[model samples]
Target: MGQKLIVGISDWKIGRGDDVLVTYALGSCIGTCLYDRTTGISGLSHIMLPDSTAIIDGHTTRMKFADTALPDMLEKMKAMGAMQGAIKAKIAGGAIMFQTSNSKFNIGQRNIEAVKAALQKLRIPIIAEDTGLNYGRTMTFWAENGAVEISSTVMGKKMI
Candidate 1:
């Protein structure tokens, strides 16, 4: 019932009231949403890469990579009274961005794949997804209703 707030890259938001959390312009990066219906608690993470093996230091940042951030995000949510078994997930982003000749630079695809593998490993079922495309997306998560919405210049806005 309040104004929606925009969460940028590498940002995560959690809420228990009527506020809606949103992010924009997701190309290769991934946006993940976790919601607990019973508690009306919701959280979202925007991740850039799949793994952090390439980083020199072991320190992790919110926007750095999914391999490190996803686990941390889940842990934080659990601390906020979100039940693991009761948490439902929705993911978006992972666009091709541009036609790249080199495979190493395909960060978007790698990010998406990493998120999927992580979720599977955690035994969390992904209720919905909008990934692997050629355009950027804007994603929103409503904590009050547990609804995830996605929008794009090419696809417009729709609930996922």
Candidate 2:
């Protein structure tokens, strides 16, 4: 019961001790959680898109894309005394949410791929994940234990 931080779409937050991080209504978006067990420090990132390079405009929301956001989050975590080698990842969301006539419109799958690639590039292993389905999700990340709780109206709740 230390603190409850609400991470909005295209945002990230870091917490420690008994703090909890939460994000809501993840449809095509992805929620990535990174934690260092030694320090009890945790970070949660909610990204809306796969890559920022796809944006034609020079202006891009850094936290809205997996390619940019994950690295940035890791840097911030390092500033908080989290070690790169000790960090582990847990992910949730990236649901199709609705039927699409074309595969290119399936942003959920693209997001899932992008997130995995980004995490791989960061050298952070994904310990668990609950992703890729037809329903939206909400995530509650507990900093004390580095547990991510995935919740959906259709599927109830589960910890990953």
Candidate 3:
């Protein structure tokens, strides 16, 4: 075990070797992780919105949306000597916090869809995912083995 890198909401981080990356309290948000076992490189992102372009010039962080964050993270991983073809993904979070009839609060599902589409466009396969529900989630990614552990109030703890 190495340092525990904490990825906050709308943030991301990369780790190598024995490092562990964790994101806290994902609800109506998505947590996406990319890993290459051979290189021992891993990236994790916490996205609050589906697309960064949707906001125009509005205030937003680079790591705050699926569209921009996914590709950017991939490129960063590649720059760090991770092979694109060898990279696999594990996604968690994207929980619907609230909903009502005719409400546009489907951010959770939309976030999941956006993440899947982005990964598909990047030609990265998602090996595992634990997503979509009414409860929040906390995710941990082990850079050494590319394993993710998910925890939550409702689901207790699980490995994905």
Candidate 4:
């Protein structure tokens, strides 16, 4: 193993060799992993929101939104020798942590939708996903093999 890179909320990290990227406590948020098997390059993003444009004020962290962060991370990955055509995606989290009646309050579902849409627009195929439940998740992405391990208190653990 090379290193353990911790991807915090509203952030992203790129890793290679035997490095592992991990993000914790995903509640109404999403953790998306992009991997290029040929190059053994992997990137993980912990996105807090669906879109930055939805914010009325421009004072927002670009990495906090799926719409902006994925592209930015992808660009950085390419710089590190990740080919766009060979990249595949795996996603987890987007849990509905709260009980809500209004659709507007269902941020988990909205985040999942936004992440899917963003990946589609970027022409990245999503290979697997575990999403849209009521439990929070912790995601661990292995750069050496492009394996995503999802763990939760309610749900045990699984690899995607």
Residue 26, candidate 3: Cα error in Å is: 0.7
- 73 Cα displacement, candidate 1 (Å): 1.2
> What is the TM-score of each predicted model, taking all chains together?
0.92, 0.97, 0.96, 0.97
- Which model is ahead, 1 or 3, in terms of TM-score? 3
Candidate 1 C-alpha lDDT tens digits along 101-159 = 99888888888889998888877789999999699999989998889889999888899
lDDT (10s digit) by residue, model 3, range 9-53: 888899999999999999989999999988999999999989887
Q: What lDDT score belongs to each candidate, Candidate 1 first?
A: 0.85, 0.94, 0.91, 0.93
CA shift at 64, candidate 2, in angstroms? 0.2
Cα TM-score of candidate 3: 0.96
Q: C-alpha displacement of 2 in model 3, angstroms? A: 1.5
Instruction: Compare candidates 1 and 4 on lDDT and give the better one.
Output: 4
Off by over 4 Å in 1: 1-3, 58-62
For residues 42-147, could you state the per-residue lDDT of candidate 4 as single tens digits?
9999999998986988777899999999999999999988989999999988888888887788999889999999999999999999998799999999999998
Candidate 1's C-alpha lDDT?
Answer: 0.85
Residue 146 lDDT in model 2? Answer: 92
What is candidate 2's CA lDDT for residue 4? 97
Off by over 4 Å in 4: none
* Descending-lDDT candidate ranking: 2, 4, 3, 1
Superposed by TM-score, candidate 2 places the C-alpha of residue 54 at a distance from the truth, in angstroms, of: 2.2
